[model samples]
Target: MKRPTTGRSRHSGGPNVGRPGFAWALPATIFFALFAIVPLIGVAVMSFTSWSGLGSPEFNGLDNWNKLLGDKVMMQSLWLSALLTLLGVVIQTPLSILLGVWAAGQQKNRAVLSAIYFIPLLLSSAAVSVLWRALLDPNFGIPGQLAGIFGGDGNLLGSQAGAIAVLTFVGAWQFTPLHTLLYQGAARSVPPVLYQAAEIDGAGTMRKFFSITLPQLRNTIVTSGILMVVGGLTTFDTVLILTKGGPGTDTTITPYYMYRKAFQSFDFGVGSAIALVLVVIATAISLIMVRATGYDKMNSAQEGI
Candidate 1:
C-alpha cells in the first residue's frame, strides 16, 4: 500500500521536476547572459546618449531616435538592408531547397554533388570577393568584357545599380551553399518509404517533388531561409571587398554603413545608435520570418507532410 498525500510538490506536474539537463544548462545560461545580454543592455543604454567613444556621454533622451527618422543616409542604409534581405530570401531560399532536393535524388553520386555544393563555402569570403572583383574588372574582367559585347557599360562595379546587383549576387552565392547542406541533411533524414510510395502512386518526378519533397522539406526550408535573412542583414566582407559601399551608398547595407560610421568617420554615438537599430531590425526580421514561413509549426507537421 502507498501513502496518499493531500498536497503535491510544486513541480509535481512538470516533466522537468527532476531533470538534470536543466541543471547542466546553468553554465551556458550564465555565459550567454554575461556576454550577450550584458552587451545588449549596454548598447540599449548607449543608444539613448550622445557619447563619442572618447569623452563623457551626455544624456540625449530620444534625440538619437528622432534623428534616425530623418537621417537620409541611415534611412538609405536601412532600405538597402531590406532590399538585400528580400533578394537573398527570394533567390537563395528556393535555389538552396532545389539543390538540396536534387542532391537527395542523386543518391548514387551524393558525395560528388555535396562536394561541389560545399566547395565555395570552404573558401574564405575575402578570396571570393577578390575573385569576383577581378571578374568584374572593366579592363580584363570576363563580366565587364562580356558586357562590352552587348554595347552595355563595361564597368559594372563602378555603377550604383551594378554594385547592388553584384553585391546581392555575391551574397546569394556565399550563403546558398550553407542552406543547401542544411536542407540536404534534412531531406536525407526523410524516409525513403515516402518516395517509394509516391512512385507507386504513379506520381511523376515533378509531382513527387512538389507534393512529397517540398512538403517534407518545409521545416528545413524555413530554417535555412531565416539563416539567409540574417546573412543578408549583416553582410559585410564581400561588399567591403567588392563594392566597398561605393557608387554613392547604393550597396551600403546597414552593417557596412555602421562600420563606416564607427571606424571611418569615428562617429561612435551615431554608430552605436545604428548598431542598436540594426539589432532591432534583425530581431524583427527573425520574428517576421518565423511567422511568415510558419517555421515554428513546421516541425510538428513535418512527419505528416
Candidate 2:
C-alpha cells in the first residue's frame, strides 16, 4: 500500500515542490539547445546538401550518404574506430582500477608516483601525438632494441598493425590517468568500515576487492567507460599528427576520415554526412551503456545501509 506524502512528494527531482526546480537547469538547457542542438541540426541539414566552404550549400538529397555506403574507407574507418575504442576500454579499465585503488591507499611514494602517472594527461593532444611521433621515430627516438620489438625499424606509423598498436598504447598512456583519477576519488569515498567488516569475515584482499571495492565503484566505472568510448570514437588529433591516416588509410578511424573528407578533400557534403553518422553512433552507444548499466536509475551504492 502506498502512503500519501506529507512533507514532500515522492519524486526528489524535477521542478517545483520542495526540491530544486526546473529553473535551476533552465539556463544550461537553453545553452545546450542553442549551441549543441542548433549546430547539430545545421549539420544534419548540411549532410543532405552539397557545399564547399566557399559558397552557399545546395540541397543534394542523399548523395552524400549514398557515397558513404559505397566507400570502403568509410567502412574500414568505422571498424577501426570500434576496434581502438574496444582496446582502449579493455586495457584502461583494469589498469586504472588497480592504480586508482593503490593510489587511494597509504602506500609510500604514492603521491610522487601518482603525479608522474598524471603527467601525460596534462599535455595537449597535439603535443602528445608529436611527442610520440618523435619518440617512435626509427632513426632518432626509440632505442634500437625497443624499436625492433615495436616494429622492426620502429616505424610504427608505417604499417597497419604497428600503427594501430601505437595509437592504442598512446591513447592508454594519455587517458589512463584521467580514468584513474575518477576511480581514486571514488575509492577514497568508500567507507573504511566496509573493509574492516570484510577483514573480520576472513576475506582476503582479492575477496574484498571483488565483493566490496568493485561493487562500490560501479557508477564510476560506467562513467569512465562512457568517456572512453566517446573520446575514442572522436579521436582525431593523434591520428592526424601521428599517423596522418597513413600507409594507405590503415589507421584512418572514422573521425580522421571525416576530417580528410571535409578539410583535406574539400568534400564538405560527405564530411557533414560522416560527422552526423559519428554523432548518431556515439549517442546510441552512450545511451545503450547508460541504460544497460542502470546508471540513469541507480542510487548510491551505500544509499540505504
**Overall lDDT per candidate, in order of appearance:** 0.80, 0.89
lDDT of 2 by residue, 44-91 (tens): 999999988887999999999999999999999999999999999999
Assess the local accuracy of residue 105 in candidate 2 as a C-alpha lDDT between 0 and 100: 83
**lDDT of each residue in 1-305, candidate 1, tens digit only:** 33323223346555434434445768999999999999888778877888666878787888877877788888898888888788889988889888877786656787787888788798899999998888778778876557646346678887787788788788777778898888888888888999899889999989988888888887777777777778788888888999888887878878888888777887666777899987887798789887877767888687343
Q: Highest TM-score: which candidate?
A: 2
Query: What would the TM-score be for candidate 2 when compared with the true structure?
Result: 0.84
Give the root-mean-square deviation of each candidate in angstroms. 5.4, 5.4
lDDT (C-alpha) at residue 128 in model 1 = 92
| Candidate 1: residue 55 lDDT (0-100) | 77
Clash pairs, candidate 1, are none
**Would you give me the overall lDDT of model 1?**
0.80
Residue 222 error for model 1, in Å?
1.4
